[model samples]
Target: MAEALDQARAGRDAAGTALVAETRAVVAAAGAMSARFRSGGRLLAFGRNGGAADAAHVAVEFTHPVIVGKRALPALSLGEDPSTLPILGRPRDIVLGIRPAPDDLAVAREHGMLTVALTMGRRRPEADHVLPALSEDPLIAREIHVTMYHLLWELVHLFLEGETEA
Candidate 1:
């Protein structure tokens, strides 16, 4: 029990160190992405298996931002709601993969939206831009995913105004 506790504490310490180092980069990328989302465009995030869960968590973070003191940013999840499931069902929506067609990439690029692709392999896409994320080791990736979003949520609050009543 003592050994396990020490290991956990060490892990937490390491995570905190990584977070502090990468906060700026994460903030900048999320800011650009957030701008695209706010400007009449949607951030289409996708991944497989646990990556999908990370994608979903990111989608929820944007759709329902949990910033302590900020306004909610406009975000949409491709697989979150049954209503928009139609969008995904249709071939028109820009889907992420190694070789998403130029036309499909254009669909997203033309809209000035950010295409956030989360994959665990070497299938990079050609889009307006890409934010390469870590997802190889599931354990660490999931932990990073959680930490990344939490920081992002906090950043949202840091940048935007507090929530308001409709």
Candidate 2:
């Protein structure tokens, strides 16, 4: 039991370290996403298997913000079929792929959409922004990804609020 606890603690520490290292990138991504939203662009997220759930969660967070009075942004989850990205995607859209295929991101880029990839450090997909997982364990990686996306959602709102105030 103690051994399991130690491993969990280590994973949490690793995730925090990785997030701290990528703080700049995360802020940049949120800024970019905010720009897209300001331009009337929608967020289109996609993933497969377990990642599909993550994608859906992202979409919900953006479309139905838990915070009261927060504006609901346009967002959608493509589920397992990213092939439709080429069809559903628009030039000003933001494509968020959670452990998605490289080809899917490439298509989004080709369509002039901004692409973001949440990777497990195994495969690097070409994207405007890439958030790589630090822990080798899948569970830890998922936890990191969840935290990253939550931060992104919050920061994007912050940028939008700043723009409105300005």
lDDT of each: 0.48, 0.89
Which one wins on lDDT? 2
Cα misplacement distance, residue 163 of candidate 2 (Å): 1.1
Each model's TM-score, in the order given? 0.56, 0.93
Candidate 1: Cα lDDT at 67? 44
User: Listing every candidate in turn, what is its Cα RMSD in Å to the true structure after a full C-alpha superposition?
Assistant: 7.0, 2.0
lDDT of 1 at 104: 38
The 10 consecutive residues of candidate 1 with the worst lDDT sum are 90-99
Record all residue pairs in model 2 with backbone atoms less than 3 Å apart, i.e. clashing.
none
